[model samples]
Target: MAQLLVTGGAGYIGSHLVLDLLLAGHDVVVVDDLSTGHHLALTRVAELAGRGCRFVHADIADVATVASALDGVDAVFHLAAFKLVTESMVAPERYFRNNVAGTAALLEAMVRAGVTRLVYSSSAAVYGPQPDAPISEDAQLNPESPYGVSKAQGETMLSWMCARRGWAATSLRYFNPVGTHHSGRIGQPQRDAAALAPRVLNALQHADQPLTVYGTDWPTPDGTCLRDYIHIADLNRAHLLALQVLLPGQHGIFNVGSGRPHSVREVLASCRRVTGREVPTTDGPRRDGDMARSTADASRFHAATGFIATGTLDDMLASAWTWAAHNPAGYAT
Candidate 1:
């Protein structure tokens, strides 16, 4: 089994990927600052791996700390970054320093340690607002938000580094990543309460509260923002497949998504139906950089690795509701 290092492995998507990597019988190591993540997620990873995993609590920008963690690692999965668009707008420097500078530091460390393969956790926001229904990998990148720019910059740097240093890299540009692991032992913890599903589920479990639907005048069937939501399990499996590609082939870029667009109203309605709660609704103005619709074309990854998302929208809502009901206060317990 290969040894893999996951940067931000305690966070939502990273934690799930860590669990999947361990289950696949690979030696795993994680580095997380716990800024927006829970230490309990790392603890749960340890519980599941049972001595097959190692975790270090440190920011990815710390070259010395990250260098030590990268020792003897074959490949790296860089997932550490500030993800919120609004927060990135308010604190662009923090996002740049953490996402861009931190990635640079990690790349330097990887080169120094002779680690030549990497799988980066990129975002669909890099494409910004596209006129097409489903965006392909070849779509023109014009990121609208600072978060998107930071991720786009990270991808550019990885591409340049891979070409210059002969390193194998894959930037998996992910669409909306949702759902929990099927086991339900570890899912998105309480720290990610601001996310869409978590917020809806939290409101549903707590009381019959009014759910705020941001921007109800979009150009869609339901007049709400449409997104391609992929399951966490499927996203993690795609990561493994990407790593395998790096083993014997050249670097590439791939999109991980279900190629289905569901509106915000539809997601909220799904949550309401699953929880059997009276989810009152309210309309609000659209947030900055909000797109009317954003979906991905998964033909590249599908042809390259034969990957497909198996979870449905109902499955995503049910798992999210299950996690929220069990942990009302997120990961505090």
Candidate 2:
């Protein structure tokens, strides 16, 4: 079994990946600052993994802290970042300093420790709004927000460092990551009140707040924006496949997504069906930098590793509703 170091493993995606790695018989060491993640989430991971896992409460930007956590680690899953497009616009410096500079520090530490294999958690925002359908991995990258710019810069730095320092890295660019673990033990427990499905389900289950639909005048079949949603469980499986593909001298980029597009109205309609409640939604002006459709052509990863996304949109929405029903306040309590 390999020893994996997961940065920000207490968060939504990170925690789910940790559980998957542990179940696959790999030892895990997680480093999280808990800025946006919950401490309770790590507690749940420990319970599920049965004491074979380690949790280090520290910031990824701290060189000494991260270096200490990297000792004897076989591979690193770098999932730590400030990931909010609107917030990044309001605070670009925070995004650059944390996402870009912090990644540089982690890479430097990996080089010093002779740990070369790394799987980076990248995003689809790097492609921005491509005026086409089914965006591929080789598309021209034109990031529109600070968050996207930071991710693009991070990918560039990873490529440059791999070439100059002989480190093997794989940047897995994700589309829209949603849903929860099928076990319903852990999920997206963000302290901030920004998540779409969780918050919408929470309002629908508890308060009768109207779910605001942002912009219904898009050029899609349903007028609302279309996005490719991947289940957290399926995403964890893809990460494991990536780890298996990362050899001593192999490095590349792959997009992890379902390759199928679903509109906002469809998702809301599914949520209403699952919860048996009228999810009231009102139309609003389009947010800046919003795209009409952003789906991925994830054939590269599938061709390389034979990993196909099997979860459907209904599965994603149902699992998200289950998680929301279990944790109503979203880690606030």
Candidate 3:
């Protein structure tokens, strides 16, 4: 069985990936600084899997941690990053340092440790503004925010590193990822998530906390932005698929999305329908570096691996609501 390391394994999607790997009979190691991730979620993951997975409570850029963690890792799922677009806009340097520079250090350690295979958790934000259609793998990357720019630059850095170090890698440019594990034990453990779905859950928990519909004036159906919301289960599955199938010397970049774009209003409606209550929301202007419409074509990745996201928006909203209902204050509860 292969030994794997997940950079953000204490976080939402990475934790799911860890459990998936363990179930597949592989050894998994998680290294997370717990900035936005909850350590309790990792505890629940170990309990649910009924196996003790190795966890190093450290950052990806920590050389000692990276070297120690990379001791026997066959591959890595790099998911650690500062993901909020608005937060990245407010603090671009932090995003660059953590997401880009941190990634560089990790790659160097991987090369030194002779671990090559990697499946990077990238974002569709790398493709800033495209036509109101499915963004193919070849879409020009004009990232509008520092977060997107950092992701784009991360991909470039990976390319160069792979070339120099003879590493094989696949970068999955994911759209909006939502939902929780069916067990409801590990989910979006971050209480202050700026993403749309978690913010809706947060609003539901508190009566006075009105959901901020940021940028309702974007050019789309109902003047709101459109995004592809893939379930966490489906998204993590893609990582496994990439890891299993990618051959050495194969450098691939693919998009991980459902290929169906749902607008903000549509997601809100789904949340309301799932919760059976009107979600209190207040209209707010668009945050800097937000896109109008962005969805993944994913045909290249699908045709290559037959991996199409099967979760619907309704399923995403339902799973999110289930997680929120089960854990009101995230892992704090």
User: Model 3 scores what on Cα lDDT?
Assistant: 0.85
Off by over 4 Å in 3: 215-219, 286-288
Q: Taking the tens digit of each residue's C-alpha lDDT, what string does model 1 give over 121-239?
A: 99998998887868999999989888999999998998787778878899999988888865555677645555677767656665666568889898899899999999888898899
Per-candidate clash tally = 2, 0, 0
Q: lDDT of each structure? A: 0.84, 0.84, 0.85
* Model 1 residue 45 distance off true place after TM-score fit, in angstroms: 2.2
Candidate 3 lDDT by residue in tens digits, 1-333: 899999988888888888888888899888899988888887888898889588898988897779888998999899999888878889999999999998988887887788889899889888888864688888888898899999998899888766776678999998889988877788885465678898887877777998888787787869888888898889978988898666676679999898888888898899888889788889999976567877889788898789988887778878888888888878888
What tens digits encode model 2's per-residue C-alpha lDDT throughout 1-333? 999999988888998888889888999999889888877887777788785478888888788878888999999999999998889989999999999998998888787777888999999989998988699989999999899999999899888877776778888999888888776678875333455676567557655667677799998888998989888878998998888777554568899999998888988888878778877777889987788888989999999999899888778878877777777666664
Clashing pairs in 2: none
In terms of TM-score, which candidate is strongest? 2
Where is model 2 more than 4 Å wrong at Cα? 190-195, 206-208, 247-250
